[model samples]
Target: MPEQSKRLIQLLENEGPMSIKRASAKLQVSERSIRNYMRQANAKSTQILTDHSKIWVQERKPASLDFSRALPQNYRERSSYIIKKKIIEKEEVDLFDLSETLYVSYSTLKNDIAKMNQEFHAFQVHFRLKKDKLVIFGEERQIRKLISHVLAQETATHIIDMETLLNNYDKNLVHIIQQEIEQIVVHPALSKNDLAKMNLILHLVIISTRCQENGGCANDALALVFRTEKEKQWFGQLIDHLQTRLAITYAKEDLEQIQVLLAGNLNFRASEPSFEMDQKNIRFTSQILDLLEKRFHVDLNREEVKELFLRHLHNLNIRAQTGGFIKNPMKESIRQISPTIYEMAIVMAVEYKKYFQVLLPEDEIAFFAIHISSWIDQSNALNQKLKTLLVCPAYLNFQSDLLQTLSTRFADELYIPHVASSEQSGMDDGYDLVVSTIPLSTVSSQKVISLSPIWTPYTQQALSEKILKIKERKKGEMIRNHFFEYFQEPFFSVVRKTSKEALLHQMCARFNEKEIVASDFEKSVLEREKACSTAFGGFAIPHPLVSSARETKVSVALCPEGVLWNNDQKVYAVFLLAINEVDKRVFLNVYEPLVSLLSDEEFMTRLSAQTDFHAFSSLLIHKIK
Candidate 1:
C-alpha cells in the first residue's frame, strides 16, 4: 500500500471514526471536503444497511450516525487517550495526571463524557469514566473494521483522486521516465519521431499504473491516460515521429497492439515482457544505430556486432582471470545512469533476440576494467611524481632532446613534459623541481640540481641522486600504526586470524550493528583484477570509494605467508581502504606512491621477508625518501 494510505488507515484505527471538522484537523484537510467524502461513503454503504426501517427512520438511526461525528472535541483529550492505550498495553501511564494536562473545566469534561456515553450505547459500546480517564468497552474486531473502512473511504476520496496523483507524486515518476527517454533519444538509427513515440508510450504506462481500476477497456483507459490537450498533441506527435524514425515499417496491427497493451487493463507483470519484445524487435535496434552514428560519431552496421562481441569477449576473458566478475559493475553503472537505461537494455535485448547471445557478462567486465584503468592512469599522471623543468643553454638543442628522452622513459610515471628556455630560467614558474644544464649566476633558492645533457652512465647516476633528494623532501612522515591504536580499546579490539567476512562482521559489531559495510567493495576490488591486473609488476593496491562503507580507515594487513594473488604474483601486503568521506586528500596523495612501490618486484620480495612491525615501518619510511 502507498505510505499516505497506510498512515491514514493507522490514524483511523487508533482514533476511531471522527467528525469532519476533527478528521480534517487530524489529517490536515478542509472540513467541507471531508464532509463531501463522508457523504459519498455513506451513499456507498447504504446498500449494506441491514434494517430498512433504521435506514429511513431518523428516530431509529444510531446516535453515532457516521465516522465524522465520532471524534473527541478537543485535541488534548484525544492525545491523552492514545498515550494511555500505548502505556496500558505496554505497561504504564498516569491517566489522572493526563486529565490535568487537557486544561478543560471539570464540568465541561463531564458533559462531554455524558454525550459520548449516550452515543456509544446505540452501537452496544460503553464509554466508562474510570479513575478520571476515558476507555471504550466494546466489540474490538467490529470497531477495527469500521476504522479501516473509514480510512479506505478517505484515501479513495482524497489522496488517490486525479489532482493529487497527477500534481504531487507524478513528478518522481516523470523524472524516471525522462531519464529512460534520453537513453534512446540520441540514437542515430532513430528519428526524432521514434523517440517521441517511445516517450508517449512510457507516459501512458505511468498514467495507467496510477489508475483506480484495472478492468477498463482501451477507450476508458485512454480517457484516464491523458489529462490535457497538450498530452493529446504529444500522443499524436509520437505516432508521427516513430513513422519517420524507423526504417522498417510498423503495420497498423503493430500500432493497435501498442495501444491495446498500454491502454488496456492488463497487469504490468503480464504486459511488460511483451512490450519489451516489441520495442527491441522494432525500436531499440534503430535507436542504437542512430546513437552510434550521430552521438558517438561511430558508423556501425549489423556485421560490426560480431567483431565488437569478439573483441569484448577476448578482453573479458583476460579480465575474468584477473578480475572476478563484470556483471555487478555493469549493473551498477547502468543503475546509476537511470532506471530507464536498465529498462531499455532489457527491452532491446529481448526484442533483438540477442538477450542471451551478446555475452553481456564479458562486455560488462571489459567496461569496468577500462573505466578503472583510465581513472588510475589519469590520477597517476596528474599527481604522481613531481614535475621538473630542464634549463639548458640556448645554443644546445640537446637540452630539448634530453627532455624528450626523459618523457619517453617516464611516460607512465609523470605528466606531459614541459621544457623551459634559458630566458625563462630564474622566473620561478610553477614547476616542482628545476634541473639546470649549467650553474646559474644567481644563487638558486628553488630546488635546483645540475645535470649533464647526456644519457651516459655518469649522467644517469647524477639524475638519480637529484630525484632521490626531491622524493625525500616531498614524502612526509608515516602514520606509524596510528590506525591500529585508534581501535585499541575494548569497543574496538583486534580481530586476529579472521576471514575477510568475519573481520567485516566484527568491525560492524564493534561500531554499530546497523552500520553495514558495502559488499560491492569486495566486488570492485575483484573486478579491478581483469584489466591489466591489479598486480602491477608485483604489488597491488585494492581500495573502494567512500560510498562503499559507513566508516573510513585504511586497514593494512601483512601476510608473511605471501599468499598468491594472481598466476604471476603473490601478495605480501594488502591495504583495505574504507573511505566514507570526501576530505581524504592525504589518503589520495599517498595512494600513487604506495601503488608504484608495490609494482616493484624487488620491493615486494623485501616487504614479504620483513617480520617485525618496526622493520616494515622502516622499509616504508626509507622507500619514501
Candidate 2:
C-alpha cells in the first residue's frame, strides 16, 4: 500500500470522531481537501469512515487516490513500489545497488525509506527491513494509484543546460571560477558586479557539491574550468598585477566568489579611465596645503602635498568600486596623523567629490578649514598655563585681583610663584617646567626651562619638547673621525652654505664620483622620505641617496643665522648624514628618539647656543638620556 493513503487511514482510526477542520489543521492542508480525502476514503472502504461525520476503522486500508497527489515526485512512487515488491516477491535487494540504479543520492534514497516508516501509520502500510532491503505489507492496487497520483502532482524544476555549460569550460576551470564567486559574496563591501559574480560562483559550487554527493566522476568538465594549467597560470599573473597596482590582498573568499560568478555565467566589466580634474579640486588642495604651512608651520612640499590629495582620490575610487557610499577610513587616518585645518579641508573635498563630477566649492572647503582652525585654537587655549606673581608691589592688591581673574578665565596647568621684587625670580617649585616673571638673570640655576612670555601654554608645551629635542639630536650629529680615515676626506661638508640643493649635491659627491646619479638619487630620496620626514623640528637633515662611507659619521653646519626655506620657519641646522653598515645599526635604533628630541625648544636653544662642535656634541649626548 502507498504510505500516504495508509497513513490517512491510520490517522482517522486513532483520532476517532474528529472533524475535517481539526484534521486539516493537523495535516497542514485545507479543510475542503481533508473532506474530499475523507469522502474518497469512504468510497474505497465502508469501514474507513462512519456515517454522520464520525469515523471508525477495523484494520487500516492501503492508501487511496486522495493521498497520492500530495507525495513528493522524486522517489516517492519508486520507494513505495520497491517496498511492496520486496514483500510480495520475498526477495532482498542491496540498498546501495538500488541507489546507484535509481541514479539518486544515497542520502535521498535513505530519506525516502525513512519517510515511508514515519508516515506509514497514516497509510496503514507496515514497513520492515532486513539486511539489504525494505518491505511494505499492504493491499497493492489502492496504494499503487495513490503513490502514482502524488508523484504526478509534485512539482520539479529542471537544471539549465548543464551539459552544454559544463562543456564550455574545463572541470578545473569551473571549480576555480566557483571558488572566486563564493568569496565575492561573503565580502563586506560588495559591488553590483561582485554580487552577480557571487551568484554565479554559488551556482557552480552547488553543482560541485551535488556531483560529489552522488559519487560522480572526479574530473568533470566543470572542475576543469578553474583548474586547467593555462587558466591557473593566467589567474596567478592577474593576481600579481592587481596586487602590485592596488596594494590590496585578495582573500580566499574573494577567489571563491569569482569562481562562483564565472561558473554561473557572469562577467566583470572594467572601469572606464578618468583624467579630468576639476578646478575646484585643484584649488581646494592648494589652499589646504597653504594653510597647513601658514597656520600650523607644517613644511609639506608641493609634490608631498599633491601626493596627499592623490591618496584621497585613490580611496574614493576604491570605495566607489566596492559600492560603498561612506567616506573612506583613510580620511580618519590622516586626521589622526595631523589634525590641522588643512587636513579637515581635504576631508571635505573627499566627501563632496562623490556627489559632483567637477570640483567642490572653494568656499565650502575654506569654511571647513576655518571651523577646524577655530576648534584647534580653542583646544590650545584650554591646554595653556597662566603666569602668576605673588610679589606685593605698589599695585599688589590690584595685581592680585587681576591675577585671580586671569586664573578663572584662561588658566590650565597654571603656575603662581612668590617674588621678592620685580627683579626677583618668581619661579614655582611645584610646577612642571617652570617659567619666571622676572628677567633671565634673576632666575636660579635649577635647570628651569624657559619659554617666551608671549607664548601661550599650548606653544610652551609644544616648544618645550621641540627645544629639548634639538639638544638630543646633536649627539647623533657628533663627528666620528674614523670616517675620515676610510674615505680620505672630511666626514661632512657644507656646499652652497644656504641652498638645500647644494647640501644634497655635496652629500651625493661624498658617495658617488659623480655629484648625482639621477635615477639612483630620485629613488634614494623617495625611500628616505617614505621612511620618515627628514625635517626634524626647524632643522632639515638633507643628505646623499647612498651611504658610501666606511663608518657612520655626521657633518654639522650650525646656521645660528637661520637660512630661508620656502616655508615660514627658518632652517637653523643642517646635518650631512653618512652611515656605514655599523653606523646604520646604531642610527636606526636612535633615529626616532633623536627626532622626537628636536621638538623640545630648550634643547634646540642650548644646541644653538654652543659655538664649538665638541661642546655641541657633549650637550647632545647629555640630553639624549
Candidate 3:
C-alpha cells in the first residue's frame, strides 16, 4: 500500500477519527484521497473509523506499514543521481545496464538524461548519449560540482560524510585536496550553510580526482563581480596552487564559477561594525520597499512590515547567490488559505526586477506573502468599526455625556463621528448605525438605537450588541459588493486549454481587447510566473507586478482538464488580475472565494463546466456567500 495508508491510520489513532476536510487539510491531500486511504487501511487492519462519508481510521496495536515496504523511486531524482555519478567517473555509462539496476525502464531514464542536459546548459557543460552510453561533455570543475549535488542528497543531513565519499572515489586524493583548501581559503572569512559546505568539499574532491585523469574545468565561462583586486589575486593564487599540485591546467571560466560558488555562497560580516544590517543590504531592502510603494496603493512602510521584510530580504539575497531555496513545505497551504496576501506578494516581488539581477523563487515570495498576511489582518481588525452618529439637541451636556459613554464602552468597535441636534440631518449622513436621544427621520428609525441619557450600564450593553450585529452586516456587504462589482459576465469564460502560459496569454489578450490593461500587463504576469509559479491547487492567480490597468478586474478562465502549472502542480481555473489602485484595499475580499474553491473539487468541476456567464456568476457568488 502507499505510505499514505499508514500515515492515515497513524493520524486517526493519535488524533481520533477526523473529518475528511480536517484530515485532508492537515495531511495535504484531497478529501477523496483521505477516504481512499481509510478504505485501504480498513482492508489491512481490523481498526476502523467512521463519520458518514468523511472519516479516517482507528487503533491497531503493533501496526506498521508492511515491513518489505519499498519507496517508489522518483524518476527525476534517481536519473540525476545516476548521470552525475557516471559523469564524474570519467567514462561513458551504459544506459541499458544502469536502467536495469535502477529498476526503471530504459526509455524513462533517457528522458531524465535529456532534462539533465538542460541543467548543464548554463554551466558550460552538456551530455552526449552515444554508443548506448551517456558521456559528460564539459570541463572537470563544472562536471564535479554538478555530480556532487547528487552525492550530497544520498546522506540524510546536508553535511557531507567525507568517509562515505572517499569510499566511492580516491581517499588519499581527497585528503590532499582537503589540506590545500584549508590552507588557502582564509582571512575576513566566508560562510557556508550545510549544503553549500558539502558542495564546496565535493567540488574539491572532483578537482583532485579529475587532475589525476588529466582534466580541468574551463576558466572564465562567465564574468563575476568580485569584492576587490586583492581578493581576486588571492583567489587566483589559490587556483594556481591547485593547478601546480594536481599537474592540471584550470580554465578561466571554471575558476570563475568556482570563485562564485565560494565567495557568492559564503556569508561574510559587513566591513562596517556600526549598523546591524550591512549598508548595502540596508540600501537594497529600502529600494525594494520604495519600488513596492510605486506599484501598490497599500502602505507597507509600517515598522513591523519593514522589519519583517528586511529580515526576509537579507536571507533572500544569500539564497539567490547560493541557489539555496529553503523548502517551504507550507507553501501550498499558505497560498490556498491566504491568496489575497499571496497575490499582493506576487505583485510586490515584480518590483525586485528593477534592483536585483537575480529573481527570488515563488516559495520566497509566498513566505513574504505570509508576513503581509498578518499585517493585513491586523489592519482589518483595527479598522473594522461601525460608523456612528449621536443626537442630543436638547442640551450640550447630554451630547457630551452620551458620546463619552459610547466611546468608553465600544472604543474599538464604534466610530462615533457625529453628535448632533434633532434637526442636524445627522441620520442622512453615511453613518452605519445611529445612537440618538430622539429619532431623526423615518428612514433612520430602524438603525437609530435609543439610549438612556443617564448613560446606564444596561443601555450601554444593549447598544454594544446592536453595534456588533451591524458590523457583521457591514463586513458581509464589503465582500458581496466588491465581488459582484468585478466578476461580471463579460469577465468570465471557460478556457479550452489549461496550460498556465497559454491560459495567461489568452486572459491578458482579453483584458487588452477590452482595453482594461496596458500592453505590458500580460508580460508582467508571465515574468512573475517565471520567477516562481502562481499555480495553487486547481487555480492560477496571475497578475502584473504593478497595477497599471485602465480598471481593476479579474479575467476569469477555466480548464476542466488540468494543465501543468509549474514543476509540481496543475491548475484548472486561471484568474488573471489587473488590479487598480482603488481595488487593492478589497483584494482580500475578492480572493476569499479561492480558499473555498480549491478545497471542493466537485464545485470547481461544476464551475469549469458552467460556460454560461449568468449561471456561472450566480453559482460562484452563491457558493462563496
**Which numbered prediction scores highest in TM-score against the true structure?**
3
Measured against the true structure, the TM-scores of the candidates, in listed sequence, are: 0.28, 0.22, 0.31
Highest lDDT: which candidate?
Answer: 3
lDDT of 3: 0.58
| Model 3 lDDT, residue 486, Cα | 66
Model 3 per-residue lDDT tens digits across residues 459-550: 86888778866754554566566676566668888766556666777778888898777788878988887887777677778877886565
Candidate 3 ranges beyond 4 A from true positions: 1-386, 391-402, 405-415, 420-429, 436-485, 488-490, 529-538, 563-571, 582-606, 621-625
Better of 2 and 3 by lDDT: 3
Worst 10 residues of 3 by lDDT: 60-69
lDDT of 2 by residue, 1-625 (tens): 3344565666654433344555666678786776666666666765455332233453322112112323324754566445533532223545776666556666777666665544333234556556756655666543442332222221110111223234433455454544443443332212323323333433343334333344443222222235223334545554454333333444443344333333222211111112245566567666655644343332332431242243334434454565543322122222322222333354445445533433333333433443333333322322223333333232534343333332332233333433333444444443333333334564444423443334466645654564354334333443232223222334333233466555555555554542212336534754675576576667777645575343344556566766554456566666656554324543554556656666687777667656765576667666655
Higher-TM-score candidate of 2 and 3 = 3
lDDT (C-alpha) at residue 283 in model 3: 79
Q: After superposition, how far is residue 31 of candidate 2 from its true place, in Å?
A: 99
Model 2 lDDT, residue 324, Cα: 40
CA lDDT, every prediction?
0.41, 0.43, 0.58
